[model samples]
Target: MNIDKITRTNPENMPAPVGQYTHITRIPRNAELFVTSGQIGADHNGLFPESLNEQVTNTFNNIKTVLESERLDAEHIIKVNVWATEKIDWDFLYAEWGQLFSTDYPAMTIGYITALGLPEIKIEIELWAAKV
Candidate 1:
């Protein structure tokens, strides 16, 4: 895929995105879309970290692993949905996010929730991707 086949736009009619993401991602026709189960703060070894920062980091690492397993990278990402049990460390998360997406940001939605699938899981991220 050339990557240009995916289009992202932040409409002038609406306020700018609150974070480092676009409002819309238009996928080309005939593109293949992939969806993943919510990725939690668990490592490949099934170890869950104790701290929020470590959990968040592990979550991102898990996301990357899932993407790679599907033969996709951040470029193939169309949307990212994040759910957190507590306030996120934006500086830390943005750093990880930047490393993953670089400048090719995709549409995203984030929410602060009360709990997740597990007690130790501080955050979960679900990804939507496409390839043309």
Candidate 2:
């Protein structure tokens, strides 16, 4: 599924993003937008893992479930925000992300914070999606 009307821009005047993200994402006025609450790194039963990699995987998995519940796919996603309590394994995280977004990268920002909602929660992800 693809929303061709959505626009993703990376201004040439600006430096390229260090990772897989655009500088801006423009959604059409006719599209329906969806905003999700930050999803934490926990399993289906709400169990958090100890390792950062496991937490990252769980976070993305949770986001996938949210999208599925909404009957939406990665093509509808336009923005993503990530928060982490510890240093991330970029390669592992990106691989997990690739399973969802593929080449349809979105505008994104990631922050390394001191903590999340729970002491065991190591990562969180928020998403904004639009369907035309």
Candidate 3:
């Protein structure tokens, strides 16, 4: 018997995801689960950058660090959630993000709003990854 994958998705007739993620995800009953805390734009020394692009880069780097600990790479990510204090520069974000993944891009959702935990921080990104 083949086990079905659990995925969360809106109606195909509905509009596509606005940002980086689908409202749904698919998982196997026996799949290994990995949960990452919301990653902020802080460095090892707790340094927060002022520039939006810098913060986005650092945020991705922070996620990479977490993924590396599990012997996983960016391509392994299946779902992602991003939060930003202001509107993101998708072009800038893509420029930096494109350097990490080759072809397989993960499902993602990016939310832009007013504030984050730290005032200096402009963005926070979290992700879920699994081997397909």
Candidate 4:
């Protein structure tokens, strides 16, 4: 199956979405659409870790878990958005990102902010993936 018409644009250029979502995605009507809830730095046991690196790692792992549940993988992802409580350590996040995604990196957005739901939690990631 082919994913149709995936598009991303600067918010300044388009009408903003009605909710927390940032963009309007247009795709083939027949293609299945997958939406994932915000994945935080929580483990399978629903525990949030204290370290930033550990939190980021768990966030990505949680994303992977959701993708796997839909019979998808990182390669199938088309877009990604990340929210972090602290200023992101670019080097660290990039290194961790390399472990999950090879050269086929998806469209990504990352925001560094003051806080998250829990003070100890460091990151939240959500993404869109489509089948090839």
Candidate 5:
């Protein structure tokens, strides 16, 4: 979807998304789009954080690095998919989410999985963004 033409909505008539996502994202024609593969909480040297909070922090930081490399930021994000192996801390996650997106939250989906690429990895995040 084209970033410039993207429209995020949560119809008042419908139930809000269970988490931090919007219910709908409309993308206009001819918009440039970028999709990132799921990012894990691994640093440049492949080190992973043990705590869920630290892992989540690293994952988002990595996402920021990727977006910046493409001349984009959180404002350009339309959707996000998150996966985690451990029980989620909703309050902690939402707090971080608030820090990242502010009020411009995007459509998102989160899942709990049994495992990730590596045993120590606790979280993964992928995103879609656009620029007109």
Candidate 6:
């Protein structure tokens, strides 16, 4: 299996996702899988931004850096899981999602929690990708 063989779908009977993501993703067996640890809005120096929007942005940037380190891009991503300590800015998140994925959305879930790893960390993201 390869990146081109990955399947993304939204069944007609099911309600659409509230954000920029597909309802399901199917990755073929035998594909190489890459999974990342949950990433927070911190830089290499362990500094985090105060704003939720900036935190979310930094979180995604960190995810990107991890993926690139493994020679993978957004297109190889099959699933994403996000955790946030505050209410999400759907518009801002969707805009950033578009920048990274365009129309090739992946299976995703976002959850609001009371707290994260640290008090200053507003958002965290983890993802799975595949390649042949």
lDDT of each: 0.90, 0.90, 0.76, 0.72, 0.85, 0.88
Please write out the lDDT profile of model 6 over residues 34-100, one tens digit for every residue.
9999989997788998999988788888888999899998888999999999998989988778778
lDDT winner, 2 or 4:
2
The digit string of per-residue lDDT tens for model 1 on 47-115 reads 998877898888888898899998999899999999999898899999989889878789999999999
Task: Compute the lDDT of residue 43 as modeled in candidate 1.
Answer: 81
If both were scored by lDDT, which would come out higher, candidate 2 or candidate 6? 2
What is the per-residue lDDT of model 4 for residues 15-123, given as tens digits with 9 covering 90 to 100? Answer: 6543223353444556566778778988889898878888888888887788888998765676788888877777777777887777546666778888778776788
In terms of lDDT, model 5 sits at: 0.85
| CA lDDT, candidate 6, residue 87 | 92
- In candidate 6, stretches whose alpha carbon ends up further than 4 angstroms from where it belongs are 1-4
Show where candidate 2 strays beyond 4 Å: 1-4
Q: Tens digits of per-residue lDDT for model 3 on 1-132?
A: 354544555668889666544555667667677778888888788998788888888888888889989998865677778899888899998876787766445677778879888789899888887754
Candidates 4 and 5: which is better by lDDT? 5
Q: Regarding TM-score, does 1 or 2 come out ahead?
A: 2
lDDT score, residue 19, model 5?
75
Task: Show model 3 residue runs off by greater than 4 Å.
Answer: 1-25
Order candidates by TM-score, high to low.
2, 1, 6, 5, 3, 4
Q: Which residue runs of candidate 5 sit more than 4 Å off their true CA positions?
A: 1-4
Off by over 4 Å in 1: 1-4
Q: Estimate the TM-score of every prediction.
A: 0.94, 0.94, 0.79, 0.73, 0.91, 0.92
Q: Which scores higher on lDDT, 3 or 6?
A: 6
Q: For model 2, how does the per-residue alpha-carbon lDDT over 13-104 read when each residue is reduced to its tens digit? A: 99998999999898987899999999988898989889999988888888989999999998889999999888999999999989998776
Q: Could you tell me which 10 consecutive residues in candidate 6 have the lowest summed lDDT?
A: 1-10
